[model samples]
Target: MLKTIFPAALILCLSAPVLRAQDLPDYVGSGQCAACHEAESQSWQGSHHQLAWTEPTADTVVADFDGTRFQNDDLTVAFSKDAAGYHAQITESDGTTTMRRVHSVAGIEPLQQYLFETEPGRLQSFDVVWDSEEKRWYHLYPDQSLPVGDGLHWAGPYKNWNARCAECHATGYEKNYDPATRSYASTQAEIGVGCEACHGPGSAHIDWAETGKPVEIPGVDAFGLTMRSTADSEGWIQQCAGCHSRREAFGDGNPVPGTPYHDAYRLMMLTPDLYFPDGQIREEVYVYGSFLQSKMYANGVSCMNCHNPHTAQLVAEGNAVCTQCHSEAGNTEFPSLPIADYDTPEHHFHEPGSEGAQCKNCHMPTQTYMGVDARADHSFRIPRPDLTPITGAPDACTNCHQDQTPEWAAQQIEAWYPDSDKRGPHFGTVFAQSAVDPAGALPDLLKIAGDEGQSDIARATAMYLMGAAADQQTARATAPLLRDDSPLLRAAAIRPQRAAPPQEQFQNLLDLLSDPIRLVRLSAAPDLLRAPVASLPPRIAERFGRVAGEWQRSLGNRLDFPETHLVLGGTALTMRNTPAAIGAFREAVTQDPQLLDAWVMLVRLEASVNGAEAANAVVEEALQANPGQPDLMAMQRELQQ
Candidate 1:
């Protein structure tokens, strides 16, 4: 039903990470920086950064707000402007008076966000619609069937920018929403992102300039404080990826620019909801996690390698950017690409210079995130439409030829790559076999898991099959890959090990408890719980307790979210706190009653602690939740016996 596809180098930098106190500049504001750094400043001016926030003025308002009246069913909206400010008033079907003041315009072209200044400089996401067809203005949120009362709609607290969006978009922004007061007094160092934002406070740098002496500043060793060196590649990447990547913030934002990525944002792991089985982007995941999964990234490729960090521009034109490493013939260092006409359509099967012929179309196909504009996958994969049904990843073919079927895409692919071993040995044949007979595909799937040359995604997918197949060898082989450098590989490596490693894998489990990706840590947490605590080292055992406590406090009542409960439940069991474990498992069961794993674990925990009665009740609940899940039926029968 859903199309799933698997998944920037920028090199030019502005400020070096290492800087003498004298090298720093004072917080002269963007206007001051605009004086000397005119080029960079001008590029940013009128761009999204400059237009991040705009006052209600004729020049700023692009929408046809000149006495415009828009209606959706019984609800009517009237736009008006005055010397004081611009406002939109909506008269709901229930006679509700909703007055929305225009605070700022979000984006240009495809879709835009209209900000409503909830307080001074504190703008909140409000009901501004996009006219998709006319490419104009319409209410994007709150359909005629859905009322503002529905918490899932845009008007809800979850969508509030003050709490969610401001930190990233606004410069020196403080999300000063006090739950005690139930109000906000948010302020910013400056309106939009400025030089000081990424470079750290220039006060120390400026002080050194005036005094001619070295001085200490907060973030001197970071982007602004230090010099940029290739040595800090991981650090530099983490700094940009802090915002760019699809990950959860582990702590507030204290992690330094050069800090290890895992120390800052915890990357979310591959899950059925977040990703397709073939490691394609599924939901609204940010890019870093996906990009890191690419072979290009693993082999020292970085965001800066392709993009100018300051201007955020591509390093070169078209396919030329790719040719830097991938030559027309072959590279002396990495001889992957054969001698061929890459730019021509003979290789691509599309007209030259057309959008369809672009290397990105086949290699980096787009998948939509944030509900609107499509984001190109960074995996830099070779097109494999044939793997769509076999691997369950959306192929580049289905992406463009949406009207056509996967079978059509596969047929087209066969014509081009007739003798191509892109599927790697028995992958194509075995993967195809898996679709028809999963049992038959188990051996080849296990072999694929151990193939080092195979794409990490394909290997990961193989590991996933092992879990469904319940193969011990596949789980054992995957355990070592958890220590793999690529987060994507590490994330997938844990899938099969979910049940196999009980005590021997406790150290590995503890090691990943602090993984940069939440998905990996979350995945490992459950494994850790099932592991024998007595076999765990004192240090690792202590880490389990620490992480479990932290997870509990942060998760709170958000346990209603299945992900929250999963992470919490896993950590709870690892700490050997059975009561907390039972509670978390119960909450998980409550949220998704059909979660077979949760039901089984809860029944086991209840049986081990509160006797057979509680276990029987949990089994009964599991049965009620799922009509006839094989796992549940088996577990229920075992418990009854």
Candidate 2:
């Protein structure tokens, strides 16, 4: 269990600061932006991005708070509105009632979630939400019976608005979390995602405007914006992906707008829990990760090509959005695209007016999330029922055909296009095969890692999955990819090298300690720490210190997260700091009592350093938090003996 959990902790540390309003001198509000760009600002009004978060008001609070009572199983919540504001009285299974005043509201269309100040400086998103379409209240997770202590409960850390949601919802947000006191002094420049959220701070641009708006040379930012107008497709895409993608942020709140995505956050790759093996959305992965795997993204397509930046809506309705490039009269913007008619029934194999004939229904299947919202896949992939059996990933055909098997769908695909070349082996086959048979799938995984034709994300994911089977042979095979041009591949390639000899590890990671990308250098710093830094040359030691400081700061930014404490505890244990490890483990379990491994580690350390009585006391606390656990029970019995 230690081996399995420790490696993950290292990765988490590699993967994962505060500001005040007065600290941000460059951020001019969106109201200032509207003065120069009225048309864009007006278009943005009432859009989801504009209303992502707002204070509770008569206009904003749409839920029925006229003393309405909503009961679910043993829990009953009464919502009421007074001159003060919207409020909820929640009665638990134990019949204890607590009154909570709504501090803010999130979203507007399909559903709206209320946020309550559960603790001083800590805002939590309530589970019960209002369905705008149905005009009724409902629980977001109707299936689960999450009690007060459960992490999934509304008041838990996972539901923290400041830590989890505020960065994306509000512009120029800073989650000022003080770890010593375990509290937040959060601040934001504005209530919602405004002009500066994507375009960066506007003070410089305002200066540019007030000083007669001097014209500058081409490629120079005349407007003084962080996101340059001359930015290419990839640069523009990263701007949107900074907030849209499901990723682990590196620092406090969101990074400055227009910062490189890799520098700000670690993009989650195609992992089994978050995505299907075929790179379809399995969880709420948002758009960026799936888009990275698409041919559209490969051909220089970006978010703005389909979505209006200001309005956050599709550029065109239905098939017109796709046919701009896919149709017989191809778009001039993409001269390389092959002209083809994809919206016809002959291509989709359905009646022209039917739902099956829709381009999105096949290429971008919708997955329902939050019970009411349905988000379409952005991969823009062709329907390949043939690969479903091999990958165990859902196909577009069988997803809609409730009674049909994947084999049936594959047969139909074969009957329609017998000579098609789309049935060739995909990387998904190798990824899925790796799960059940790592040794057998390793050769193919290495091949995929080296395949330049595949997306860098896919190659990086292949390298990440190969960590389970790390050995000298696997490390040697993947060594060439360590110097790959892509930062993602460079970062992932370091994981497998853990199997190499100590001298080999030192030699291989020395250059990466000063790698151009911060993420890559941070990735190498942990593995390089195993070597004695003081014994190294002066220049090399300095490089290690700089990168190690970056790694430490990255961990410091995420101290609010319970798992970050777990990583701290693991790092302390590795450095032979027993007391520090004990403190970290204690903090981890205190923040999240359900953290079983932290409790176990804490008990072990207490028993060694203190006494069996101290360990027994911890065991009793662990049993109270997680009752009837075999490991804790066994530990308790041993301590008694």
- Clash count of each predicted structure: 30, 1
lDDT of 1 by residue, 356-458 (tens): 7888878887886444668877767677666676667788877778899889987887888789777554354555566567777888877886787766556
Best by lDDT: 2
Best-fitting candidate, scored by TM-score: 2
Report RMSD for candidate 2: 3.8
Candidate 2 lDDT over residue span 1-641, tens digit each:
22222243343343222332333337888899887899999999988999899989998988999999899896899999998899999998668899999999998989999999988999999989999999999988888877788666788888899988999999888887878788999988898899888887777677788896843533227777767767888888999998889988877776777678887888898999988888889999989999999999989998989999899899999888989889999999888899989888768889896888888998999899998999999998888887888887888998889799988988988888889888887999999988888878889989999889999989999988887687888888888878988888999899888888777877887899768887888788778766543366668666766676678778877877888888788777776668778878888887788889999999899899889999999999999988898999999999999
> Candidate 2: minimum summed lDDT over ten consecutive residues — where?
1-10
- Model 2, position 264, has a per-residue lDDT of 80
lDDT (C-alpha) at residue 453 in model 1: 72
- Assess candidate 1 and give its TM-score to the true structure: 0.70
Candidate 2 accuracy as TM-score: 0.94
